[model samples]
Target: MNKIKIIAKKNQKEIRIDKFIKDNIRQNISRNQIQKLTISGKILVNQHIVKKNYKIKPLDFVEIEISNIPTIRDHLEYNNIIAEKINLDIIHEDEDIIVVNKPAGMVVHPGFGNYQGTLIHGIKYHFQNSNMKNFHLYRSGLVHRLDKDTSGLLVLAKNEYSKQCLSQQFYYRTIQREYRALIWGNILKEKGIITGFIGRDPKNRKRMTIFRNDEYHKGKYSITYYKVLERFQYLTYISCNIKTGKTHQIRTHFKYLGHPLFNDSIYGGNQIFMRKKYSNKNIEFLKTFLKILPRQALHAISISFIHPKNKKCYFHSPIPEDFQMVLQKCRKIFLQ
Candidate 1:
């Protein structure tokens, strides 16, 4: 284990916690690493946990402890992950990159109890069949990720150079992504931008929530722009373009906006909001729609990014049948 301790003097007052730690500690941990430690309570001020942006005052004591436990990645060996043959919907493939239309219910990569039937396994199998060079099972070739239930276009690099270039594009926010989703309530705004700080829910680690006003210091800044595509009596279809890609960002932001994604199990969208009056027919239709679309009604519809070869690449994925079914049902039933 590695531990760092610092006591702030008058000269260090008001210095941001992350910067303060970086300057005081000999370790070269990054701002993001510091933020994660703070969030997880591994970093503390005056024996009390603080956010990454907390300002250190005079006599404030900061402690950081890094555990030596091996991560899940370290435990994974090449032989541990058997490359079971699985179909990959390869949308675009070239020497440097592969763009795939990932389907709902498919895990992007394996970890913990899930080590098989993942996209990585499928890709490994594909690489084996093609005798691709410079392929490593551990690398997985993934640059970014979509949730297991979120179907969309995902780009995979074929080698280290391509991976580095693509990863930088994502890190710098030079890549463009667009999504389509159906939410539980009709939005009055034709177009709007939602801004808030997003972080893990203190009570539930599995979910994310937005913070505003006094709680703004709790999470990283996130921005989501949405335009209403269609509105029904009980739900609305919208397109979302996110400026920041925080975990569960789209789901959390819309939930904060009072319109959780339809059928989203974790963010209060799985149940009907009975506050609004619903006709018996509409109620029945909603139940049926929920069954039709069991997952969150979100889809990554498009993405655009600069290729490693200095060219622009854009790809669009049509809405899946499940999404189309619910939308069709909305038109036929909710519009009646």
Candidate 2:
């Protein structure tokens, strides 16, 4: 089952539960289906099953769990993912593999709706033009993937043998990944670990849901170790070290901890959730500061592993200019 969780904001006006669901989903879901869900005890308002006609108030948390909802977007790294002249930041290269600093806004691989101008395209073009013979390219050399908007250090295998070796290292939790993320709130703890089960949200196939209870669908066990790097009055910068590479693990875990990454729209991080009292000037300043970073303020800064060929190598990508600018703005805010 998939789950859709929504929290009514203070800025929102009173609305019926059914209408709220449709408005938030932004997809074609009929009222009859919603009614059926209500009957089946699939809709919850503030942790209680609520009727379709129930009027939702501000600050009420609503959750809708369902079984069938098609994802809105589709992409597959199949025949359509062709080579192109895409810009690539090559950090390190060898006969067996290539390490790249993947920038934000570049898709890792192609899919049904998004097949053009991906990192794989660039890799393929690089291989085709190079004199590296005896190299057999399959699976586009990607052992793992980073989200389109997630800038990070990604290692790609050039041959099948390297791919298999690297894949096992990741599976055995030998690869080390450290990410820097700016999240919404100030966490009480300086350093801690978060553990939970994660699976596809039944209400929305586009997102992942965290399961606190083990019975919630035999979900994959996910763990994240976070250290508070810096603390703003309203926001906290953290370094997340993940043990298991579940999809959206860091982002989802931070949200589950009530500190969604800054500007992460998928997990409701875009909303201006602040703790301190706000003045007109403060709000205006915040609006301007937020505009500095268009995407989620998360960066995969460092990755280390036992290389399939070289034996010992570490890759690092500095924070992008946009993310740096956002940090500058936040620092200015703190100083003021």
Candidate 3:
């Protein structure tokens, strides 16, 4: 149980325990929440259990304990999305949020072609099994999204208030997010920032493009800061920090710098870039290894943001297995 402590001051007036708590707590704790805490004996006054109507005096100490509520099992509302049971790698879970380590190739949410087998679907199924309340309220608690091919930490809200709080952080760009990717070609600079206007491709509707000065007004301006972590003969592992979340900000910006992410087909990464001709044996080996990781080699390695209910707490996600696996194989080959 989480605990919160409040002390009455010399100028404090005789008020109800619930009102004192509602006014003193940092979070927007409601009167109903305090009453529920009282029923569960979670509210204490001077180390003794107290009712909601208990009057507070100067120097009175109030302590509150919060625990997950036990609710009856309810079926998940499967609205055009199937909540099928699947193996989910849940990283962390609290009363207000859930952090998931999403694997590669799993769509973050359902789309036209994918009605099942999404991260949202699997997580919702797990919640249904646990019989947790407020977890099914959202579009399955998903507040943000990742590309189907990109893998790593993703956070989901458990209730309406938490959702709003998390969404606001992302909207204001206060959240810290960093991604690691294997890009084709060696970077000339150790670190640099790429600024460009990003928008849907004028030539192809399926892709995003970088706009020039004349076309800046037509596209949304975006910024990406990148630094080389490890370099290889034909590829480099880089970390990217995105300032503006356009459709394909990271991939498009890297391509604009002439280095698309390895194996990303949509942005001209599939072709053999950079190095000149190679031996047939080397070509065959590279092709086989690339085929093993058919999707783009990008992972959301780090994410941090304030907790919805707790002002001092922050959330984080570590690198997943797929990203490590691909990195290992590339390092083994390229470093040799």
Candidate 4:
């Protein structure tokens, strides 16, 4: 059996026992399974079995035991993940790793409806050119992932050892990621943290939603830290640091706080939601900015991780042009 241990940290209070375990573990164990494990004494709080409804307190120690968890490669079909020649914005590359700046609209790897022309396909082409033969397509060295429409830095490993080392870092939450986002409205707090569980919206299959504190059984625990960089008349430019990388984490967190990301159609930022009354010119000007930024106004700006060579490395990517244009227009119109 594989053992998973967690130390409840700040902002993780009053979370149900089963919900806490589900949020922290990567394995697909349902709450019912967790309840079974608790009854079987496989899940424990402070070395003692507790009821599933028991709330986790700060600094509480939780341990879970379960069978080996299957990795992505184990269940995915890699036979169709073929190589394709495409341009990649490589920020850094070494024998052990390849760090690439993934552009917005590019899927990181092969998946349903996106098997070709992915970053993995391009990486395979790159590996072939570099004579790194016999690399597994599934093990194409992706340490982490970004959304298809989210531009950011991603590091891929060249060998199993490198993959293991990097993947462990992510598993231990040692990797650091930072993002720049333009969210709707002028938030009052200069800096704040949003904490919640994130899971797929029952109403919309394509989107994710932030579960309330009481709805712990619904989603994975997610935390987002944001600091306002610039406050515009109708929007706010902010820097985000995510403690937990859940699907649509930053977007959902901001939306939960009533400030959806600018132009994030799925999260309700595509249309105006702040105030009903604005001058026609202001509304049209906002529409012009939205046209400038066709996607959610978010960018992965920086990342830091431990290299396989036992050295620390940091990488940064400038906000892409479309996002930059929106910022410039906002500054010109709102600040001036």
**How does candidate 3 score on lDDT?**
0.75
For model 1, the superposed segments whose C-alpha errors exceed 4 Å read 1-79, 137-139
In order, candidate lDDTs are 0.81, 0.77, 0.75, 0.81
TM-scores, in order shown? 0.79, 0.74, 0.71, 0.78
Give the Cα-based TM-score of candidate 3 against the true structure.
0.71
Model 3, span 1-336: residue lDDT tens: 467777799888998888888888786667876765664455767655566678899988777765322222212234445677989878788878888878888988765798788887787788878876334463655666788888878888888678667765655567777899889888899999999878789899888998997876456668889999999767788999886666778989999999999888998787767536566666676677577778788888777889986564444566556557767877887788
Query: How many steric overlaps are in each model, in order?
Result: 0, 11, 0, 1
lDDT, residue 272, model 2:
82
Give the lowest summed-lDDT range of ten residues in model 1.
67-76
Better of 1 and 2 by TM-score: 1
Full-model lDDT, candidate 1: 0.81
lDDT of 2 at 207: 79
Give the winner by lDDT: 1 or 3: 1
TM-score leader: 1
- Screening candidate 1 with a backbone cut-off below 3 angstroms (N, C-alpha, C), the clashing residue pairs are none
Error of 2 at 48 (Å): 31
Off by over 4 Å in 4: 1-76, 137-139
Model 4, span 141-169: residue lDDT tens: 56578998889888888876787677666
Write down the TM-score for model 2: 0.74
